[model samples]
Target: MVDDVADSVGSVRPNCSRSWSNSGSFDLRFASDANGKYPSKIDFHQIGAGFGGHFWFAHTRKPGAMGGKMKVTGTWTLDHERTGPMKIMAALPDHGAHTEIANYRVNATRGPGGRVTKQPGDGVRWVSIGTYMFDGVVPKVTLSSETPYGTGENDIAFDAMAFIPIDGQYHEHTVEADALFDENQNIDTAAPESWLNESPLESRERLYNWAMTMSDKILSMKNCDSEVGDCLTPHVGAAVANWRSEVMAAGKDPINHPDGNSISSWIGFANSYKDRPDSYTRPDSFDDDSRFKIRTKATTTFVSDENGKIVPGSQSASYANRTADTHLPHFVLELFRAISEDYKISLPDLGYRAKDLNEHNGEYTSVDPLRSGIIPGRAYSYGGQAPKLTTYTGSGEQRGATCVAVRTVAGGSIGYRTLLSKEGPTTAMSDFSDTLSNSQYVAQSVWELVENIREMFFDSGSFPVVESSLYNVAPPIWQDLNFRACTNETVRKVDGYPILRASWMPDHYLYHNGTAMDQSGALRKTSLPLMRGDFENFSTATIEVAHEYTPYGQCRAYVEDNSFARNKNPWGINPVPRPGFNPSSVQFCSDPDLAPDPEYSSYDVS
Candidate 1:
């Protein structure tokens, strides 16, 4: 079976979920200064201190830039001088898009001689805990010791890496459904014709410049006003070095190249050199007439120019792991931007500013956690009530609960009116419904259609009895339906006939009946309100009750023989007439006597 498929059309695989799985295993070692404890506070220079007793964000080796599932295996060993007992703990974020592969724990058991080891092993007792997937999120690890540093007892040595499984990484983009509705194939004219939003490269230069500025900013942060290497320094240094190396191999002189000694100076400064002079550039020839070139880690064989077109024969200036090289700078910029405020980094030029990074302490910062993850906030809810409404409309001055008229097709005259309000306390009241907010009206309507369809095909019992196995098979478009928990329990067609019984909220029922509000089953409670469409309704239609059949999966022909004695107006605009109907009259046609007059002939087949 095709698990998922995306097309140019708006219809998409509604319920399919994407995630990362563990690829392989690696290790983590933590030093005292990196622990953020006393004797070494995480100040400007101590970037590692920020991750002390907490998590630090970094990249992995196996997956490279295009991320995936990562299996993290490592040993957590304590490096304390006088260790009586200590706690060694490590963790990966279980929030945001990053899901924990499994629940695990590591206990640091002190072996003889103040030596800590894992259970059931020798030489530091290595324990393998996770088969994790970071997806697009930057991987982070957290560490803590029973006795923290500067206490003369707590010190930790952590060394770990993630092995990204190459396969479980790619995710298909979700389609933006704007023009069409999922049910009745309705189209909304106000919606844009095209779902795709084609954007120009408006922020290309700004983003590039931001990356450069971030590179500079990270280097400028000083502890005690002295420059020092932190976790990110090496990456920038390596990138610059690689870029400069490519320039030189292209036979470009360091003094004359546009990037010039700038990249070189950055590299040298990161490496603790006061300044790098031109003598550092080797005069050796990089050219070889032979087809084979010197082996390097570069992934690309040709360099691209400003327009992104390949520069002819510019092999020497080509980049390796081009995808990683392309995105690493952006990652640095975004990561810093997430926590920049706490560190006193200036905004205005960073494109966006974030509130609190620690709010997502154990979550994936897949660029920005807030953009992908939802944070639930509580709203004060007080009870109120509204009296029964008296309505004067096409439906005979209906005086009852609230109902809404929805136009299925844009600009068409007919509207489908469905009863929505529930019968409850007399006092005025308002609350959030299962349909969610105003923006979700379309999704809620679509969900209602699917819910009714399921009821018609399976619970109504009006059609031929489908095999029980068929009932288990999910409908193509029904996956998006949010059905009620009590639906299966309450819907039982013992008579083997249409559940015209005053309540079955079936699709066909919507065609000829109006429903009342009732709640029979109440299960779990949540912050979000229950969907009103989920409950069974109250309608005063004639019910042809049938006896409970003896065996299940009895396939029989649908209603095939009726005297055509009566017919009802399919539209609920007028009250349907009731006739002396035969309970055994198994026919698809409605009673002819109740059919609508010529003026109100048009009806929707629900």
Candidate 2:
């Protein structure tokens, strides 16, 4: 923001020592007549440099032709002023600078609004003129314009008093008076070379050039600009050559030598001169060439039989029989431990173990040199069960041991899989039926719990009090966990992925339970211990419901089905029982026929 220090009228306090005046013409005066004699006032003039300031004009008289009238418009600037002895014949310097002014003319006609609208005549015509004036010190300058007959003639004058501040203020000065003219004329011509020819070029150049030269000289005054600390002349080409030679001589092998490789040589040269000329040299050391060598040592270990000979396993002859002894058992145990830790479940281990083999042979007749018999019953048969043992082998025979092993216990273990539906009932179908039944039981238990909570809140004046009384006087422990799980599920679905776990559920549940219990107790003026007990029960029930309902696939399916049911019958009149059975309902049955009436069914007696 530029400051608006000058008033709207453009006035400034004048210095008492300065004398100024303005003639009605385009002339101005500034003088200090030390003689104190009239007409002896030293003068400063305004030379017509060009038109700039505001100006106006009026016609002298109306034209005979209605629209054939000439009007003038102009602007001007003072160029230069002259000052010399007033009437001295001593050939005093011309002592005056040039000034100029400009104006324009156009034909116009009067319009209904008293407007002087320009006619379809010549465009604004410009006229420029210059003048020179002198007094003993500075001269007066003025500008005037004359229009054609019947057109107005106007004159503009600049007040020397107003300009006194500008003259008295600080301004750039030039030694050669001619320099002022060159500036006014907008000339780029350099100062006369004659002055340079008479003096040293070093002293004649501009300050900037002098500073640059000094910087360059200081930079080049030092030595040891090479990597080997070798002294070289202050030139880039020579320094690079010297540094390269030093690096090549440091090694006997051509490929290994720093200068023998283009990249290394370039890097070495750059490092050598990085800060050499301007300051102390600091070069980087080269990398050791041995880093490029490849290792030939083997990283893999192999297992062998008792006879120190390879055994035949599933697909090929084995060099090391990991399954024959310790390897397979160790690896299997490790895998079991890892799975148990991951699933947070424990499993009992089988006593028998086998070794990891580098190769396998499917032929049963192959002898096991280490063991007495042929692989010691490589195929296990229990209760006449067809080979209950699992063979761990890879496709390629000679590629080494199988990275992993498969364990086949006598009876199948608990595992997760998608159950396939069968048209006809079978043993597998029965097992799936059992699983489905269990899932329904769990789902129904959770849904009933939620409905009970909702109903309690609706029926009781105090929602928390009812919730506490129904769910063991514990705080509303499950609200935070359920809300967070719901929110997380939404976020995961929106991000195009499935929600794996509700990591924040436990903490969220605790926080909300505490808050609810505290607020309820405060409102009811109940004992803290009673409130806490109530809260604890409510929280426990809520958490039980949330935990059983909010697993990955379970939560996603529940939300989808609930959302669908809500959207289909937004009025909440849907009387259809949920997919899973509700243990809390009086009619707790698995039959769909005995379920609650459909909320949207038209089979009504009305």
Candidate 3:
């Protein structure tokens, strides 16, 4: 926050050194001041320069007329003198028509002296009109007629006005005589220009121009008069002194200075010459012109059955460890890791952490994502059992961090926090209290803007591809072992299309065309035949590699691979329960004749 020193009433510099006095008679406005009746003889003050067109009027007394009634309002800088009161004096032709004080308003200043019922002779006599107490060096005032003039003789003719210290009162000022302010304080004295709203080059150029103008105005020795010798020089220097004492010396930032400067330039004005840096990061080095793509990561998609079942034997072909494009899926985890590395902090990894029967008296809170469990990476499985899976639950239930709302903030950025709901048989949900920190809350506030983007991601119904080096495929290593089927290539070929092993490749995707095909050991490369058949039974069909490679060397997908048996537990026994199964440890039941025997088979740790 910038200090508001210049704006305070106590800091005003009085217009005391010289009397800001105006005089003369007859009907005249500042316009007529140079021509008609009272030609304003005083033109040296800023009152004339700052208000060139505005005027103070003087006229003969007349009732309800725009005469003898003048009101002028403007800023007045006073010397910072607390000891004495300044006197305000006004005059009129001694052949006076009664003119009572109309309205006198001076903020926190004192008094309009007793109105003069009589002045000595007809040659205009100046009486002690009003006494003004100084709140600061400068004070602002407005004066007008109390009662309208009546249709009488030419009685009240405003003659003159003056503001001066009540004789012999030593008035003081806040700024010193020799203080110097450079151009640095002029341009950089306000809020920073946002890079999102303006380009770096444009912001820099504007600042540069402002600095150059200030430099010329402040440093140049021209524009000086005999009385005020370079008036701006002292005031400008004073502004710099004020900035250093009030802001810089106190260790506050002079860039975006707090209190406004009286002069346009200051001590640190050179800082304005610095440039603003670019903020957006792009993946041009990765050869991926796609938006928000990370060259270091790729998305590996694992397809599961419609019932959300994880078949143990198919784990290897189904699980690929590549990064995703657009980055929403792994954005949080990646951000956390990056922050951890940069700050040298040991943040927890993104994985499950079952309640330890030892710590916290083994009485952990139920369904707490922060302590009890965490969803595995790439937790979002589209068109599967769980659409939103950022949150993890202690028990096997659909109770993870499900984002129901998002918010946007400055720079059009977004952040997301978890939302809890009670639906179906699950009565409990995870509230995001433990999910975000104070700083994270700021990020999540901005994240609210992602709701629209979230809708787009779901609507596309397609997975993003990233660089292949991101993930390592699981075992069952189908690509390593050739077909062990005791059969030749002739039998493996169906309708003249060769059968190939389904291996997880980098930057490759498996596409499913919403068609119904037989859940058999093998599938066809073409969807023309399958589209004609009834697909209702396969609402959530399986997808596999189509033609080993597309014409452009990209891999094509073939859905409904039924050649392999439905995956069973690696051993002949079901070792674990639903939702908590770790697909990484899955092993294939290689023996075709082997049947599950609950009593005979034992659970083995892979």
Candidate 4:
């Protein structure tokens, strides 16, 4: 048999070999304080300067100037620090140096001579950007720069890529400088605000909406079959059918369609119908006089106390008796009635016999008079009750006696009495035989009713006798019907015959006898891995259930005629095992003539 199928589909596999990139750039500005010290003499004539082994922008004249260059001077300091966590020990002193450079644009006009000039058409503009580094003790500015030319006169810009370390790796962001001005050549701080607002960040709502639309489209196109007339025509049909089967197999319900209106209203409606009450009509009675009833009898043992008062002992037995009155029998009868009504069949009540009891006395003589001179014994009969009800009373105060009584009420009731004895005392009562026997009779009557109803619905010949063996009961016989000997063919052809064996494995047997131990001493291991390996080797093992028919000429039939024997021998059966038997091995067959060539076997050989 194939391995049990999984109850639900597994999680969707994800693509492992895919990659993507996120790229963007931002513009920023810088600010600095004036009066900062310059390390070297300023060169206002040139457009660049070398300060502390780093390049810096110097003020210069605009194009079309004749001889003199512009001179712009400004002092600035840079501040920088890393954000987020760092692996450095807090106990140790932190020493790091960071630097920022300012870009300045010079607004000036040259003079006639080849000498430098100082002029400010727009007030000197300064914006800083650069890098800083630090040792274990204190931070120091590593690189700093400022634009030498003022805005509009000559555009001066500062550009740097900031590297931020994440997960022990650095991600770099390209930063560019944009000079913002207001008619004058001063730096504007609001230049950074617009760049910050346009930062690269994903929107969660857009992603959700896209996923929803894709899922709906996938569901819509799942199993579209438009050609076949009787097949599920639409893709949605196949998808829903497959989904419903999966949900049912997993012991779950399908997801309900969302309401076009408010979800709360739909939820409320669903909750209202979750556990709606069921309506059942009252059951009919088997007999008009019969009624359902419960009868209980409590038997208590008492011991004499020191004060001569009877005290109840813990050792006592309570018997609860229930009789089939109109309710229970009516319920049973009503089940058949309902089945009959639903199937549009008629059922007739089969007659039943009442409870019966009888007794016969016998006499025997012995040699010893005191021990057993004459022995009197009674044999109880199993038949209907006698006309007159009788009650027996004991002659001695403490003597043993037997009492038998039957309740004739439509609904049975409990009748109990206390017996007291001074020496040896015992009491015997028998009434449940009738009650239990009546219950069985009622059950059989219901069965007969169902049988008749079934006969009405199905073809007369098709409705078999429904052998009691199907229910593990003895075959029933009708007193007026003739008994026929069952032929072996008839007995073997019967269907649905229940075997008289244990249906469930006993706990002890299952734990000990049924469990198989592996080489590692682990119990209850399946041979799935071994079987899978075997299949992988041969590449011919079947993975699904399928059918193959053997021609009638290729098979043989055995016959047996001894119906009375428990284990009969079939004619034409061989006693010895068949040829090529291997108890501990799996067999694989291959015909050389039918097999493909080895070279082409690996390619499209199915």
Q: lDDT tens digits, residues 1-606, model 2?
A: 000111132233333222222221232122223353322111112322211221122222123322322322222222233231111000001112111111111111110101111111122222111111133223222222221222222222221211110111111100000000000111111223112222111121222232233324323434433322212233322333343344334322213433323222221111121211121111111111111100000011112233322122211000011011111112123322432342233332112222111111111122221122111112111000010111122222322322111111000000000000111212322333234234422223222322332222111112322221111111101110001011011110111111111111111101111121121111112211111111111112223233332111111212422311101110111112111111111110111122222110111100
- Tens digit of per-residue lDDT, candidate 1, span 396-508: 12223111111110000000000001112000111111222132212232223223322221121222113111112111000000001110112111112221211011111
TM-score of each model, paired residue for residue: 0.14, 0.11, 0.17, 0.13
Question: C-alpha displacement of 563 in model 2, angstroms?
Answer: 51
lDDT score, candidate 1: 0.19
- Per-residue lDDT of candidate 4, residues 193-246 (tens digit): 212222110112222233233334334432323332122223323433443333
Give the deviation of candidate 4 from the true structure as CA RMSD.
49.0
Runs of candidate 3 with Cα error greater than 4 angstroms are: 1-334, 337-444, 447-577, 582-606
Clashes (candidate 4): 38
Quantify all predictions' global Cα lDDT against the true fold: 0.19, 0.18, 0.23, 0.18
Winning candidate number (lDDT): 3
Model 4: weakest 10-residue lDDT segment is 476-485
- Comparison by TM-score, 1 against 3, better one: 3
The C-alpha RMSD in Å for every predicted model, in order, reads 33.0, 49.0, 39.9, 49.0
TM-score: which is higher, 3 or 4?
3
Which candidate has the highest TM-score of all?
3
